[model samples]
Target: MTSQPTPFVIGIDGPSGSGKSSVSRAVATQLGAGYLDTGAMYRALTWWCCHTEIDLGNAAAITRAAVELPLDIGDDPSAPTVVVDGTDVAEAIRTSEVSSLVSTVATVPEVRVEMQRRQRELIEQIAARHGSCVAEGRDVTTVIAPDAQVRILLTASEEARLRRRSLEVHGATDEAAIDATRDQVVRRDRDDSTVSQFTEAADGVSVVDTSDLDFEGSVAAVMALVDAARRR
Candidate 1:
């Protein structure tokens, strides 16, 4: 008879467009675990702020929104959904407008605290329901889940990251598309780094560079790290 697989938390951190979202989802799917894209929480909050016309410049108001933010994030790796209040903002939050301003809401210290709190609660709840969970975001490995069983800092060269973001945001990888996406990807990294150290690996967290790895390769690499941790 086969033994039962151990339940664990896999914390993955990386800058935007480093394939953290895709890789984490694939890893969770392979392990039959739940997946949480913490970045989407920020993005959803940004969408809410915009929807309610709350001034993004008002740090206090943003924090208030974060505290009361009615977020319903699905845990299925195959059909991940993020619903805010009574509306589904999954696709809305990914818009260029939301992407450009999400860093603003995410940078507020109080907002971060509130969102991190929600993320931790969700992680525990998901892990309890599913066998395990793969939660990925800028601070997952450091702040969100420092004691996670498997912590990974996924990184890639600037050029590679730019190409991926260009394809994702604009559905193209041409020079013009990459140039257009540079501001969003580069500037967000600058702003997000102020609150979380995702560019570098924290203590006890492994680094996975996907500059040379394809999609399947990246997924396999993360899975390998998870497997190693499970054995230990």
Candidate 2:
């Protein structure tokens, strides 16, 4: 395979509100690379499931939806869009409906298997296109790209996460639902990362706690690590 101008990749795996998206994007900007938000890909697929009326509990149907889904990862590093089939779903995929169902759809072993496959393919393609990338998701460093050049595990307190969620989903969800959703998301993370075997980071992965740092601070922290690795 043809490699991009750079071969290095930094993977950031974290639970919600750990600020993986903001951190990864900023890290990519700092490194002059690309960024991939893996969670949005799953959410995009979940949104497609809703649009096509596929039952989340039906593994067979869901797997078929994932397989037949014409998902495209856009070429630009600035956007890195996910266009499903012919439609641009970069915005639609982040909906509360899709966010709530994303864990259920992503948890299905069949769906994870397929998405994992796509995930790896996309990483390689991104590396080919933009040289290096900082990919952020729950299972990215451990499961999707174990051999990545640099792996950063980001974590934060649930309270911080809820605060961030409140800002993001205030219009889409009520306060009670937001509270419940926060608990459910934490539960989903535990289930997928622990019970479902996506918890552990691969060897040489650095774990960072973002409980105190702001978004730019976290980006700076990861960039420091990436720069150090490049020197080695």
Candidate 3:
């Protein structure tokens, strides 16, 4: 029998619009690794709550939903999927309704506890299968995979983050779009901050600022860090 090679895990944390998701996915593809989006787990849980009519304000109820969530998330960087209870919800979880309320569900202590447990397990499985895995989210560095081979905290200025998010969601970077995108990028971060620290790089975790970097530039910056870490 052949022994499985040890996996190289990369943990990345960043606030919304910091480009962590896109950058991490690209890096995973470049390295022939699996990808995990921890935030999408929270979003899937929130969608389940809404689908089952669980009260988001009720901590106990939300926690119960988290415990019973039948979530199936894909690890492919090129074609990730999120499914719940046999239904594909990758798109539903990204809807405005889920976006507005996901923070509430994510802030529940028990929910984070449950989700983090599952996330750790998933990361291990993904890495074992693909030889490497790149996991990114608000707390992947601090909470989920602190001991990963490479850790990164991606960041961007508030103005730059807001503009990027506006362009992503509203398809424009005008003043109106920025104003509309502020709540999603800023308010969500504030609420999530209560549960996880992502704005600053923790000890031994490298920081990558994408405030001025375009998509390709951001990917290159993170890949450079990955290469340096492997060399060290």
List, residue by residue over 131-191, the lDDT tens digit for candidate 2. Answer: 8877888678878888898988887777766666666666445567568567546766766
- Residues 1-232, candidate 1: write the lDDT tens digits: 9986656899999987899999998899999999999999999999999999999889999999999899999999999999999899999999999989999999999999999999999999899889799999979998999999999999999999999999988899999999999989999999988887899898999999999999999999988888888888
What are the candidates' C-alpha RMSDs?
Answer: 2.2, 3.1, 1.2
Q: Quote the positional error of residue 24 for candidate 3 in Å.
A: 0.8
TM-score per candidate, chains pooled: 0.97, 0.88, 0.97
Better of 1 and 2 by lDDT: 1
Per-residue lDDT tens digits for candidate 3, residues 171-218, read 999999999989889999999999899988899899999999999999
lDDT comparing candidate 1 with the true structure: 0.93
In candidate 2, which residue pairs get closer than 3 Å at backbone N, Cα or C atoms, i.e. clash? none
Candidate 3: what lDDT?
0.93
- Give each model's whole-structure lDDT: 0.93, 0.78, 0.93
Off by over 4 Å in 2: 1-6, 75-77, 171-184, 194-202
Best candidate, TM-score-wise? 3
TM-score winner between 2 and 3, please give it.
Answer: 3
Name the regions of candidate 1 deviating beyond 4 angstroms: 1-6
Cα error, residue 43 of model 1, in Å, equals 0.5
